[model samples]
Target chain A: MTVKVEKIEGGIPHNTIMVAGLIASVVLVYLTYANVLTGTQYFAFFGGLATVAALVWGSHTIKHLCSYGIGTGVPSAGMMAFGSGVIAMLFATKYGIAAPIVAVILAAVVGAILGYVANNVLNMKIPVMIVSLVEMAVIGALVLMGYAAMMSGSFELSALTTGSVSILGLSLPSYQASFLGGALIATAFMLGGIAIQHPFNACLGPSWTQDRMLYLAAECGFLSMIAAAIMSMPLISMGAALVSLFVAVIGWYYTYAKYIELSKRDAFSWLDSKPIPEVEGQ
Target chain B: MESIVFGIGITALAGALATVAGAAENTESDIGSQGDPNSQVQLAPQMGYLHRIFNKAIAGEPPAWGLWIALGAGIAWAFMAMQVNPILAIVLGAALATFVQGVYATTAYLGRTASLAKFGQPVFVDVLKSMTTVTMAHAFVAIFATVTVCHLMNAALGHPFPLPLLGLVWGIALGAAGSATGNPFYGKERQYQNQKYGAGVPIAASGNIVRYAEAGERNSLDNGWFSARLGGPASGVCFGLIVFLELWRTVLFEHIAAGWGAIIIGIIIILVFMVIDRYIEVWARKNYGPYGKPAEEASS
Candidate 1:
């Protein structure tokens, strides 16, 4: 008698697993604001980690959709996602944490409409086009808002408008707003964009697997959070930045090791073998 | 003052929404300051006539060392002009922007060629062509976006941004976006014919290079023609929206109120592109097909 072999499935669907983690992270960060976590360092460090986690999920989706070979190119998908995200975050911060629901509704509506148009009208022809577009936009918003809150040290309307003056029908810039708008927002914006999109773009082909991509995603996300911490140096407490830097290094090393392990399993070890002839110096 | 439910909901839903998008996939340059023939880069001949034309127009070889020199001068001139007059500043700035982009295009071509060659795949002119197309769009977006951001921020803050600082922001952002978007197209266009150990199995293999929305035959005039027609307007619209929104935000006391308007307008602008992109898709599919237009038809 012959026995049939069955292909094993991931214990939880990849998307489900990532989203659950993302939600948990956001809620945990909010606890810091609620006096539940206590300490500026607590908010900054955890908030940075949460922001990176969102991008990790974003990167996974990028890999999923781009694998289909969207004609417009992979980075376009990332750009489009960030574009919507930037808008949502700006609007959300304008309202402060008081009206969080507005930004959520705003991001979803924009993403859904864009996705619908991409799939139905543009005929982007990817099987996952609509869902991918919406998710990308929404996550983009989360990454932006989360990082903004951490850097500003709170989720207040003043985070956006605090640094400007009104003069002769023109608004003047304030150092705080400039730092947030220009440096902090710009770094998080671009870093989150790349963290989510770069993995799949770098690792496309037959060797590409969900497991491997997620591992790489985790690595990129941690690195970007480290970037956020560095950019936040002028604004956040030094303790917060130091803690974030430490956590990022540990997070990156762990994820990178997992990625290497996966890569070793699939890649040719011969490629890493020592050369038959040593270099002249050696 | 705190509602954990709503606050958490905002992030949670956004994350969940990203999940739907996320669950969807389930996962997955340096140019400058050097010389000598040995150090200078060159392109393969098969890159063809368009390569020659580009080289000639830029007044140097394919890597445009001469133009790189001109770009240095242009930047210096632009900075000087900034001290003289706004009109002169604008003119010199435009000149500087052109040379800056020319350097970028040349560098991108050389950079992309080296990258592909490292993997053992020969690049076609279409690789350069596709990159230049995206570069033009992104260059336009980056310049305008930078100017708008700086101008508005300065106006709002009652202090002007240092010109050098503005230039840095503008140049860095443009360069970043270009490399981010352009390199992937090169990776996508070619794959190993026989590789079990590698990642590059074609998603749908026809052995033909796949371009996203390029019009007409590969390397044909019509292809260049349509790409300009589509990409140019789309980029222009993006630039316009950014400029308008920045202006509106700067002038209004209610900046966030204006932000809402900006968001709506932004969505509309994107929707318009969607309509145009859709129209282009239909046109290309009906007229071109996978192999593109017949050579005879292409010539006409």
Candidate 2:
């Protein structure tokens, strides 16, 4: 079965997610100011924000902002800042002002650095498993060192989880398993993205046509690879290779096909002489 | 003038914004993969005839001027700013900044790409997208980190600077400087793709410095005159140094307000350099047509 992560079936719009989170933060602040929020609730709020910021900054969606104008809004980057503030709240009871400030600062540093590299160093197009393996390695190291702060409580991204399986006394790093699986999913998407887009554009000249394919493949690869790596690491306790193989083919196919189909569709709409509105990632 | 302060503030704000944005935003592009070198969005064209010309003109390898300057100025600047063992601050701050920002870029890059791919989104494909920004951001990061480290050091030495405001000042100062220097060299040409810088930066004897901008009027009929050829790195020295010195003095402000004034002056210096970095330096390099051997002995 073809798995499509794009155009999630009746899933919340990216913007809606932002707005919802913003509201949550506002309410959180209001509640905190009102002295109504319990300590646990506040920490949870902060944790959620950090996870989202880290995810967004760490995601391939950043590429969308540069190309298709998907997640480039103020709220997108602001999500991390808000998340940082929220995460800081987690340590507020213990550290006071320093807690939130330090948490947000660290979160921002982590999120932004990863985001910058995703856009800059990697050129945002490493292969799915490649990104997954690298992230898993780091996440694993983190887990080993007993510093799995972010993953221990990321209920927001828990949707990637299927069911927890125990191996050695405790859970088999459910977050790591999810992360590896997600990376595979991202890879499958781009493969699909390129597969669907390449065939129909046979009309262009040789060099022009080849360049177009490269561009498409790059986009699909970058997005999926990044997404899977960030979202799937914690889920990767299923074994890196297993999780990678599980999601790789499907993620690549859907993502590649989605773009290929979009390209063909966009190409055809122009043929019928209809102007198409600029879609999410132009 | 009030306009100057406002402009300084606004400029500082812009650098700060980009710094924070760069700090927060994730950018990772793969090369030789499905990634597009273009996706890295830079103002300078990666390849050009002008770049070839400069490469040919350079004839020899570029001297380590820019690098040395960055290293040396960094130390000197630190010493002047804070007399607590200047070289120590430079080495420590620059090293720390490089390592920190480097890891930050690597992890952020990985995380961002993974997320985008999660939804089957297309990741950007550019090579130089974050190169200049990261370098310049380091200017800010290093400055801020230095200040913080210095602040702690000061406390240990029975003196302390306001932690928050010191970060703000150091960040703004270095950011403005970086935007002025690195951006023009790396960022400007992708836009104009015709600029250059000389003297301070030694390129290949073949002028292999492939940049978008060129310095001064390399091809003017008046190339015979002293003004045009002498204008770039050489002229830049006299023109900007006075102001640079004044600002340096300000960073060592005996009073807090002086520090603010110093930051403002430093911003001006940075802005001036940025203008040159973008317009003049880049234009010169591009116009000069690569850093290489002159037009006479053409292999063509």
Candidate 3:
């Protein structure tokens, strides 16, 4: 007749587990980075590992303990920081040393620190204003650091990303293939994120909204580097282009559409003590 | 000076309203003290409205900050598209904005408490009926205020693509989608929610903070079919459609002006609905509130 929803005396054990998970996750990431086979073979090889890692080691299992599991505001914000770093690496590195070394290290370090501080120290219970502050800091840091990284190297950083980058790898038969691939992948990522979040919320009491954001981040993690090869014509083939197009399309859907409240997976957020106030100054 | 002045004005108004309403409720509660246990005089119906209004009016409050955050996040998020292709930016921004809006709204709704609502006379639902009046006030202020500020921001930034007009369009476009995002399944017995422990109130009724707080005292929150879908990803698909149309018009057609067009469409929709409906017109009239049906109702 009466089932009381009890708050766990400030839930000490649960908070410890969460903090431990963050530390463990950041550390284990070193292993994911340790073995990176270069080339198309590497895509299937290490990319497979990353996905598996996300499945086994990432927040999926934690879903049992947490109402939100991987889908939550605190987790989402953590992923945003980590994901931003990964995306930045995707842009800055040659997919050689960057993916293997720099990206993983930076993601683990920056993400864990931000996560620990926000959840544990600052008690990230504030409104969305902190998100803006976090974004500005992360992006601003990335841009400045990335600019320096680009400058130290002889290549012009601006020129590197300009539309002129040559399309290498495989070639597609027709433009239709590229279009078709993009559309299909976009749907998969969008639907996949939704699908994952759906079953998760059923299991975890919370909506698990972070799952959608994380999946989007993971998808973008690898896709950013080889996108041009997938998009360019003459060199772009239906298969590779499909790969590129789908990857791009999915990223587009998740970042824009699915990332919004459409799924409600991120519904139950970390209710911290002090709400983050609106930023009054730069 | 302007920001501080506005903040003080809003804070004072909210305070004044709370004082008058709380006093009025107190006087009435004292007269009727024999029956109701809610005479502690801690919570006030007007205070609920005030809490909400302050959150809305604060310069960096969710209502106000959401715009800048949404806009900035939208534009920066577009960079992810740069990795994919130029066209993906528009698609990404719309979808992202939609999701953010949905999550915040749903999150806001679910956290509301119904037990707080019942602590008074002049039933909370009566206050809820007046939502139309307040929502209209806020919406007009939001629209003109948003459009004007957007225009000014555009001028400040050198007027890219009709400048402030884009803000109006962005607002309307968001508002319309806001309507859709706000719509979803919720209820205690729903399979997705798996209401095992006697179904704690459906998460959708959170939109009505008054009912949410007051109803917390009883077995309530059985808002039926509409509440169940409130948190589902179906809203995502709806967001996709909006993003697609806007993207095709603004990015693909190369008619950047079309970006503002959605605002016109949003305005027309709101106007039509306003003309036909009463207080129920502005909100989805879900016939339910979000916070587990005021606390006084049955657990379900």
Candidate 4:
């Protein structure tokens, strides 16, 4: 007799999840611009929400692409998405109010071309490769811009490139504190790339499910947000940074609990193994 | 206007340099059996079919290239600040980076092979001595070209990003392009050549690499020769075109309507590629006649 194992599956369709995440992120990220217009950084934490949404979309796309059996290409795909997306994001920041929109367009173009090359030129023969790449690229750009807005309180080119420090209760320009000038953009790139890729990498297997992966993705996003919030302390107001941190902690807790609950539900059995007992000295 | 023209010129130069870098980078990785394919090489030993293959996968291509380019650019940036000749500084920095890469190749090859000694895989010192230099030479060419492209973007084009950051971004891009577009030719075609062409490695055949070459037992050096003909150049064009088109659009259209022109052109470019990609996919499917089986068999 042969025994067959079936993968357990139940969740919202991936397309619906992707579209919802995309729309939510784009709207939430724009709120940062509105907050900037009000000359206060209070709503800057919207950027963290936007990042979580984008990572959710991105992790799903990664799951879709890696299903094609591109052996060990999972992390490479994530890095490629961010590598190209970053160029688009940096370029788009020059446009004041339209930076986010321009970034999406630019990233889509870059991602589409990469997909074309991978399919036609390299002949990878994966059917959804092109569309998956385009989505990954846009998600990557959104994540970067979101984190940039979170830390710098704006995504404008001047805001990203200029530094500021408080000297004796007065704000003053200082190159060392700037995002680009201080090489903080590199940190953002690594943080965003890991957050987008790690969930799928950690959860992928024969029995992997979408809900668990996405929940972990959100948890990773919030963890990254906490880091960005800490980094933002040097760049934005202390009150704004603390608020971002508070929100990130709450998001992280909710997602972490959900992920654990899902793991228990999907698991065939669970053993709460304790630490090995120490032997007495001989 | 002059700056835009200069930017266009710089973009062209950077594209040319990137092409060389991409080619060299892919060839070097293929020769060393680095990145994802290194797993197969490692598995070959465990499965009891181990010849001489250089396994120098310290990390994936992106992070490895990121560290190398960042180091090169950092050193070059410092020297340029001290008023050294830019060309000399770049050469010195690339040489130093190449030395570090060679050291990594040596240790990785020795350590991984030594660990597999229980599986009867011998640590070939001669293979290590010879291949390390070849990898280093290719690494130097790739590093030098990438660093020059970063310098052109930062110093000549006046891109607001610093040299090291530009290096990191472009370095990761180059590595990604090579890993995505080139590795299959080495991993599937070169290493698993005994399998029928276009039929991917099946699960049952994992770790079963072709151990013999046309003349004698196969090795990583043989893989290099095969990948150089197609994989290396293909990766070059992929990366080179990405850099060229990205800079080209910005140079030609960035100023119009507050950079909206570039956005519009970018959309047009994507639509064109979408059409081309669809055509290619259909053509490949018709010509190749489905992956693993004949048309009649597949239909049945």
Candidate 5:
């Protein structure tokens, strides 16, 4: 007997979520810039929220692309997104206020090229490969830049490499010292990647539903945000980092509970088991 | 003008090194039955078709390569900072990284096989003893070449990023290239050779891989010999072109119109590949004619 995969139809479409995520991320990340101009890092947690928004979009794209049955491409696609995104993000950071837009454009172009090569040269032949890749790449750039902004309280290359100047009796450490110097970008890369990929990967199968997967994605995003907040402790003010951490923890708890509820609703049977029994021969 | 010439030289050398690294990486992965195809290898024992395929997939290619190359380049960078000879430093770093790769490979194999003990799959110590060295050798070559390319990008091309960062980036690209290009050949053609060409693996035949050799029984080492010829070279070209074109655009066109020229060139390259892909797709469809008949009908 064949097992038919159950997909709950008529939820919010992926495209809509993607668009909402894009808008929310862009606007939220700009809050960091605003905080920068205001001479305070108090609003830096907005950058963590921005990362969560980007990961939500990224998780959808990963699901769309992996549905094509490119076995093992899930992690590769995630890594490739960040690989190209890092190049574009680093280049864009040089442009100051224009950096975010520049990063989006550059990442889109790089992702398109990589996607084209995957389709044409390598012959993966998934229909949505190019567009999904472009989205993932942009999302990757946003996550990295957002987390960096949160940690450093600015996305400017100079501000990132060198600590922010004194403003309103508040100063942040250089990103080079706090982020790249300790290779925290690598941590960010892995954190963002696992968050984006794990939702679909863990929930994949005939029993998987879109809502459950997405909630898990949000939960994973909050978990990564918690890590980001902890990592920012040395760079940003302790109060700001603590607040970010607190918010992320709250978000994680809510999402995790929702995900568990969804899982229980979907499962054929739910049980609490005791310890294993001894063998008859024993 | 002189700097352009120097840039061109660096691009060429880096591209060449990337090509060799890509080839070695593909061969190494195919030999170990790593990547997406390892799913089949892992499934086989559980499905009661225990085989001797070496399973060494601790992580996906990108993260694995990122760790290896980053560690190598980090050590090399440290040594160079301490006034060590660049070449010697690179070699030492790569050698140490290769050792780490071997450790990962051994543990992965042992651990995976140990878990399958309930399936009556015995640990072939000989397979472990031989395949580990082979994978280590190829990994060394790949790591060495990749570290050199990152060094050139840092020392020669005046790239602002440090050595370890460059290593991490390009190492990911290399692994992505190999995983995308070569894994298909190994997964579809090499492992599932019993299936007809151009007919994709059906869902029904998921865990049932071709386990026997022409003589007695198949092992992972045999896969290396076959994949090295075609899959390895294909992966090499893919990665080599990526490195060459990316560096070429940066070197020649990055200054034109404040870097829009490089962006335009990148778009043009994508357009060219799209055209080629269309041609290939049309050609394959015309030749294969839509998968023909059902498996049962074809066999009958």
Candidate 6:
């Protein structure tokens, strides 16, 4: 009953799709958040989802490399990716128009440096540590920038911190608004990364498949969007919650379907339904 | 007014929910094995000094590194805060130190799998996967969650806070705790794991490793709900709350010791947190104890 997925190696085309999705989602989401886009700001919600979907490439890299095993665990790979991501995002946000390009470059360089250190200086001798880390770094940047774009409507620091200011008529003290915003974004940042890391870690085994994992990745992304919606509800229109819930529910459908299928496909018969009585000692 | 309150409620609810979900997913990443049929072998490298230091801590020896790491980090932070700017320095310092601790803990944790190489282990890949899981868990649950909460309190609650200083203290504490907790969890799991999959590393049964993997079938994701869903996040939230309260005190009472107050506060925090964390550990052990036999017996 084990569903066997081949070793998934994403080549140039696959990588291109992920990168393209990341850029497109970030740019479009940013525009939507900034009110430059034609549609409602809620489109940025989907953009956030897309950004996470793109990061699925990074997750796939984790799956492929983790099959080799990272001594710390699968989540370490995701953390490393996102760790570099937040830094690159900080730098990119400070620069306008050049944000995506700058972030990508910084992510690659940072990831490479981290990988080199782990392999050479750290002497851990993880062969793919360099490439996996490099990919993870880029994915991390995309996730951060993409999430930022979706939530704040732009990559600017102010956009991220200004959530509390949008609360109508409260005239809440400056500190209160700023603190509220920071907390909210921090939540999104932490949780969004989870969406990417969770699929590979949870579903891994011989029976794991990239397609199924990607579905879970989308579900995770939707879950993150829900967090974003809750955080940004003060800033955005009332529909943010409903829309976010709608997307999450829909995404969960696909993710859960694949999960059930995979589980059934991989289940051991003895563990199904009732447990069989144990035989006497041989 | 009504909406703001509603927003606050939703944010807290969402943050808590996300924290739970993230922590649960993180639980899966805590363990890796060498004998998996799907695994591939890679280069086996020797452990370094830092890894050895971390190993001692993980193996339940008094963590010699905590005091030194904290003192060193505190000095660096104080210098930066006094000489340069306070806020940015704290943030960067915390962020950087957390990342460093993440690497330190992960390296030692991975080193334990060296024994599996003789039995055809994919040392490199396994280590990386293991590192990936635990590091991310530390980063998300311990580091980010703590920082976010601190910022929320500082800004929203209108406290005079030094963000990074709190982050640094909490980071070191969490790192130490993660290392300390990790050793036993790894020990117990390896015992059950070696028996289930084949011989590998030895683990003490004195509740050494906290049995991260669920009970029942080897590596089965089902069976143990407590470890996966509750244990990690519950501990994480508790740790975060402790960090918040302690750091809040330091910032609130910084006038007491000139600039050096944070250092004193930091040390007190480490000591107090360690004590509380130990009790928490004992409670966890007493309640959700390991399900496996001794490593020797199980593997045999």
**Strongest candidate by lDDT:** 4
Candidate 3, RMSD to the unseen true structure: 19.1
- Number of the candidate with higher lDDT, 2 or 6: 6
After superposing candidate 3 on the true structure, give the runs of residues whose Cα lies further than 4 Å from its correct spot: A1-46, A60-92, A120-122, A125-202, A205-282, B1-300
Candidate 5's residue-wise lDDT over A52-108, tens digit each?
889888877887777666546666677777878888888999999888889999999
Of 3 and 6, the candidate ranking higher by lDDT: 6
Clashes of each: 16, 181, 74, 0, 0, 36
In order, the first chain's TM-score in every candidate is 0.80, 0.25, 0.35, 0.91, 0.89, 0.80
- Tens-digit lDDT string for candidate 5 (B1-300): 999999999999999999999999999998888878888887776666667678776467877777667757765664564346999989977886786577557645654555455555556666777888999999999999999998998889888887767877887888889999999888888888988777777877776787778876677788998899999999999999999999998899989999899999999998999999899989978877676555485553
Reference contacts reproduced by model 5: 0.01
Off-target runs (Cα >4 Å) in candidate 5 are A1-282, B293-300
Better of 4 and 6 by lDDT: 4
Per-residue lDDT, model 1, residue A97, is 52
| Ranking 2 against 6 by TM-score, winner | 6
lDDT by residue (A195-262, candidate 1, tens digit) is 56655544443334567666766776776665555444444555776777788779877876786566
* DockQ, candidate no. 3: 0.01
Cα deviation of B17 in candidate 4 (Å)?
Answer: 0.5
Task: Show the colliding residue pairs in model 5.
Answer: none
RMSD of each: 16.7, 19.2, 19.1, 14.0, 11.9, 14.1
Docking class of 2: incorrect
Clashing pairs in 4: none
**C-alpha TM-score for every candidate:** 0.49, 0.30, 0.31, 0.55, 0.56, 0.56
List, residue by residue over B142-182, the lDDT tens digit for candidate 3: 33333333333333323353321254244434333433332
DockQ of 1: 0.02
The residue-level lDDT of candidate 5 at B58 comes to 46
Provide the lDDT at A138 for model 4. Answer: 90
User: Can you list each candidate's DockQ?
Assistant: 0.02, 0.04, 0.01, 0.03, 0.03, 0.02
Candidate 6 per-residue C-alpha lDDT over A104-141 given as tens digits, one digit per residue, 9 for 90 to 100: 78988999999899888978676567887887787788
Ranking according to TM-score, highest score first: 5, 6, 4, 1, 3, 2
lDDT of 1 at A49: 66
Comparing 1 and 4 on DockQ, the stronger one: 4
